[model samples]
Target: MSAAPSPAPPRETRQREVISRLLQSAEGPLGVPELHARALNELPRLGVATVYRTLKLLQEQGAAHIVTLDGENLYEASGRGHHHHFSCRQCGRVYTLNTCPVALPAGTVYPGGFVVEAHEVTLYGLCPACAPR
Candidate 1:
């Protein structure tokens, strides 16, 4: 007989709810520090360790994912679907690019006969506010 799937994680606590809402509503992915700071507004006594644990749980549950930009890891809700990111060097901020520019078809074969299963693209440049007119 096939084994049954494991039970889902316990229902979210008040703290996890705050963290999850922040991730879902953020304009872009947020690093731990940013997420913690924002969460503190609603949950003044929230601990950094709790934030770390909650993020880990979210990732394990496929409710969130990490985006690494300029060596910093950021978190965003998984419901965003297929998309990429852009990093502003001057502002040190990462933004989500809702529209994908890549047109590669699935199962595309490379020059060496390697098939493309997935891809990630990150664009780096100055954001509008940082760009010189």
Candidate 2:
């Protein structure tokens, strides 16, 4: 006989829906306050605690990743493949860069015996809109 399928884990329906909307509408990492603010439009009862808890759960499940910048914890959906990020200083907007400029030679090693595996680069600058004319 075939093996039985595993049951799904318990879900927080409203919280999940809120997270879905945030992930879908966001183009970059979103802070909890921003997420809550946007989600509150549709879910009047949405709470800050729910957003935090759901973010934690989603990060644990690899469904989302944390982007820390300027002492703030921002959340973004994962599974987009290898890429870098850029943060605008003036507007405080985060952007995803498709190209990775760092190229290491074969058998390169660090001074502390650390081997390179993967890396994430975050560039800082003024975005087009915020740049001086």
Candidate 3:
């Protein structure tokens, strides 16, 4: 006989738990592979594709946020207040700053017809640990 369909996690509960874990262990944002790797330790049967799908869903639903630059996307739990990123080019590690310093002041002039909803700032350079030896 065919196996019955598996039950889906309740969205609010699953998203909240995911966010809590991501925040508690946050070294920075996590990419899909990293998220999957971490999830494997918790939800062993979770697939990489599922991770990507969940991330996308979270981003769309404003439950999680992503910081992308140079073709890679990094993810973190949302509702932590505004946040920004710092990337260590030497070691290729990504980190989050407590406060964002690079963004322009709100109400700064922009093209008349353009409506800016959100902006992501990614700083590239060596992190303290990755400084030249």
For model 1, what is the error of residue 70's alpha carbon versus the real structure, in angstroms, after optimal superposition?
2.8
Which has the higher TM-score value, candidate number 1 or candidate number 3? 1
Q: For model 2, how does the per-residue alpha-carbon lDDT over 3-120 read when each residue is reduced to its tens digit?
A: 8998787666877866866775686788888888888888888889989888888888788988887778888888877777789999888877778878864466889987777677
Q: Please give the distance, in angstroms, between residue 104's alpha carbon in candidate 3 and its true position after superposition.
A: 2.3
The C-alpha TM-scores of every prediction are 0.88, 0.80, 0.69
Error of 3 at 67 (Å): 1.8
lDDT of 3 by residue, 1-133 (tens): 9999987755565634664476447878877787777777777777777677777777776777766767887788787777778889888888887787766665566788665566667789999998977
Between which residue pairs do clashes occur in model 2?
A: none
Please list the C-alpha lDDT of all candidates, in the order they appear.
Answer: 0.91, 0.82, 0.73
Clashing pairs in 3: none
lDDT for model 2, on a 0 to 1 scale? 0.82
Relative to the true structure, candidate 1 reaches a TM of 0.88
- Number of backbone-clashing residue pairs for each candidate, in the order shown: 0, 0, 0
For residue 109, model 2's alpha carbon misses the true position, in angstroms, by 1.8
Which structure among the candidates has the greatest TM-score? 1
Model 1 scores worst on lDDT over the 10 consecutive residues at: 65-74
Model 2 error, position 99 (Å): 1.9
lDDT over C-alpha atoms for residue 70 of model 1: 72
Which residue ranges in model 1 land beyond 4 Å of their true spot? 1-8
